[model samples]
Target chain A: MTTRTPFDIPAHASSDDPRVTLDEALGTFEPIPPYPPRTEREAEFYTLRDGEMFVNMGPQHPSTHGVLRIVLKIDGENVVDLDPVLGYLHRGVEKLCENADYHQAICYTDPLEYISSLFCEWSPVIAFEKLLDVQVPRRAEYIRVLSGELNRIASHALFMGWFALDLGGLTPILWSFIERDEIVEMLAALTGQRMLFNYFRIGGVNGDLNHEFMSRLGTWMSKATHQIDSNNALLNENEIFVRRARGLGVIDTATALNMCMTGPNLRATGVPFDVRRAHPYSIYPELDFDIPSRTEGDCLARYLLRMDEIKQSLRIIDQCLHEMPDGPVMAKMPRLIRPRPGRAYAAVEGPRGQYSTYAISDGTDQPYRMRIHDPSFVHLQAVGLLTPGNLIADTMAIMASLDPVMGGVDK
Target chain B: MDRALRRRLEARFGEELTGPVRQRHDETEIRIAPGDLPEVMLALHDEPDLRFRLLSDLAGVDTGTTMQTVYHLWSDSSADWLRVIADGLSRDDPRVPSVTFLWKGAEWMEREAYDMFGITFEGNRDLRRIYMPPDYTSFPLRKDFFLPDDASRSPGGGVRPMEQTHGPTNAETAAHVRQASSS
Candidate 1:
């Protein structure tokens, strides 16, 4: 048998290059004999040989948390090849956005990234604001920060809960949901919905936070802090949790940077890149909080970083509640938003990572085009790199650690 | 690496730069010709101060007459965001060069653009249906694509609500209650 090396293509190649043909380039690397035809006597033509095992993980598995099917080729206990098949829960959200009005489209954004619904809403809302040249009021900015932080805490809690669930612990999922429910209730009071809160408008928020909501939030924040501390002591101190997660999905700083992984996943690799601190949108410049980072780029490090981020989010929320100025929740925007013929992009440090929106307004009330930059979408790319050369069991651990809400992925 | 670098880019890529490279209302937008997209993107990615190595998003916009593609690139090292706009192509022939080779993150974004706007990328592989079904007809995002209207549907073709009787007998009411309870 003759083996060939992987083909190396230049970064920039001219259109006239003879090696542009995909078949010719790939053919040079390997030559495998064609498969024999299936016979009537044979039950199946594609049966696995003695050592090879082919397993279909799920379009309905618990670890994925959504309809994501992964076809794994295993050699003994180690995974040799993993091909991710998508489109199981495809709802054609982008196509639906095209038909929906700019304001009405906010309803779909929340569902796009169900885990971090607020950030999804923020992306489109902020983009619309930029396209229309509308400045949000100070009170609205404070309210936006408060809501965004609450959503962040909620998302991280779900991640922590789900990560523990993947590692075979049932208690943390229940414990995490308690904090998540409180935050969701606080958000529901302002937005009038629980899961997909379409509360952010182009110019500012949809409405103001009431006194009762603020008081309840203050109480929930203190209770959540105590619960998180106690929960951490219970879970973080467990020897099994530590052993499975400590260095299972170790990604170095260079690979993390190259892969474009963001949010807590990237921060866990020791690169203190928080878009809130870096870009500083929506009164984030004034808010004081630490950008959490960990030297170990592993599953445990990401878990620790997310926990720290939740604390930091609490600090930001407390500050916003204290310093929130009394004013109109929304700015004076035109009845019909007909922006000049130009394109603009707005990004925020979402619960997942850097959620961005690129909108093109061509002198019309409706956006000419809209593109959402989901952090989970980019972070999911690192999964293939991390999972290879690891055992099948460890693969689930790494995927859970990444915390990719597949709605964001398949959107 | 600062103001000087912007000036150098402006001078070297003259009309290719399109408009003045400046922030408008706290957001930065840089326009370039379709052909100049790869060069401008490379320069933005390579420049020390403007190390926008990550192509955060790539989306297409239709202006009724033409289609425009926007690229949002961000640098993790610098925490800087740069919005690059390429001139629109005709709706009939929406073709653009792919940037997957430079940044692998553009793989899904470009596929999304293709799926929604019917804009074809020259070098992208595995460009089959993304969010929509493989057999779905017509681009749903286009302004002209209309949703199915019940008013326009032929008589008896549209879904109609089940007719209800004003008064119900004891047996009929009991049957309804039983059905509801079972459901």
Candidate 2:
């Protein structure tokens, strides 16, 4: 064994060649031969047929959205099989939450899905509240619904851009970003951050809606639907975009349910099984909104389903604003919360489907075990099932349509 | 809580359950022995009146004494989220049946549970580490993993475990060196 000190400057520290150690670490990246297969699964995945070959795509590729690497076994251009290699971004968020106090634990989950951090924060906050059995004030619940809907619109806006960009269109991303930026700025005015907004607190939100947020929301709500529709017209009817996406990666409803797929991806397959409508939680039963669904179950269907859902979110936000309640935002709770020894499971309808948290408290300040079930992790697993019969080019299209953020996948 | 759903679960599997069916808030849970996992899961999936088609979440928990594999199921037949816990598995050799035959997507969640808590799913074909390095020996999420202690004795630390074992300096000195580095 070799010995080293923490402060030691290695032999290559001053060397201009950065690629020297990296080259040694990369070591061909071949499936099997130098490194023997450790499990039956590895052996099966690595055993390529005579006409088939493996193509390694992005732990760094642009279309991957985050640092997700997928190894594809291809026969010419058609993909025979694909295996997703995760953990490039794993930070052990569950373990971290176990170590942290209940209130502080919300910070760890904030970055799990960077694009939809509000939903990420909402699940755990609600779970912790359930464990403590605190009833949040009605106004706070309304604020959560309002801001969460705004965040969902922002998340879907980014999704529209990324989906079109993956299909080789550049202008749609620019248009979508402008729309996304407006909502993001409004959220920043409401909460204090743009990206990983740790705004959701246990039993309520961090603060009530401010004047700037309301003014911005009022301005944006008037023309938001028209802007999104005008931006979508660039690719919604285009022959190339529609043809490329329409029939690609079609997953039937039964298969989707069997795979435990949730959110818009499953809705695209014609089952309107949304957590909000099915299992009503946190002011959703009071809100008047429809769970938009599509029957095609293709990449195009998934893309269009999200577009329909965004209009529904705007409607929900409008209703929340009109029916704003008069009460304090926060519930009565201890500063150092010690929930009773029990378990609680809370799920919210996120932009990516059911973002849920299962917490087991040992009647202590810290959770005994906090199990976070990210939909991206579950949705990404079905990629191997969906991409087998399609071409290698269509793999990225299917993945983009499914929209698995790597942060959530690797958490 | 849905009292009818709880009654349906109790009537269906009263003999198989290890404990009373627990209902709290919007959740209902049942605990069963590890041996009864496959049959119970099959009945939950196949029976028309109790068709819990959607497997919402699967997680493994190490409660310092024994291991548990928990399954959260969502179905239209029930109004509450049904949580089925396969409890009382020996921590040294925790083994449970794979639910992949029912929900193929559970293959990954089972892999993740195995990766974190070292619980083995007997019939899972792809039972490899989902998050950790392939050669990693210790499970990170196990109760006895002791992360902070292991982090102090990491390879790059000035006071190596080897030095504490054989060198003239005592274990306290090694701990001191770790603190010095952390500072």
Q: Residues A1-411, candidate 1: write the lDDT tens digits.
A: 234223555657665764543443342311111434223212131345578766777778878779987766678898766656567777766656644668777787779987678888887888788767788899999998999899999999988899999999999999899888988888888888888888888888888887767777978877878888987886789999998899888998877766667788889998898888877788999989999999899999999899999899989988998898998999887666677766567788987788887766656565556667777777776776788788998888999998888998887
Candidate 2 lDDT, A195-221, residue by residue in tens: 889998998888988999989989999
Candidate 2 lDDT (Cα, 0 to 1): 0.87
Quote the positional error of residue A222 for candidate 2 in Å. 1.5
User: What are the lDDT figures for the candidates, one per model?
Assistant: 0.73, 0.87
Separate DockQ for every predicted complex: 0.16, 0.37
- Total clashing residue pairs per candidate? 0, 1
Instruction: Give the candidate number with the greatest lDDT.
Output: 2
Clashing pairs in 2: A263-A353
Q: TM-score of every model?
A: 0.81, 0.91
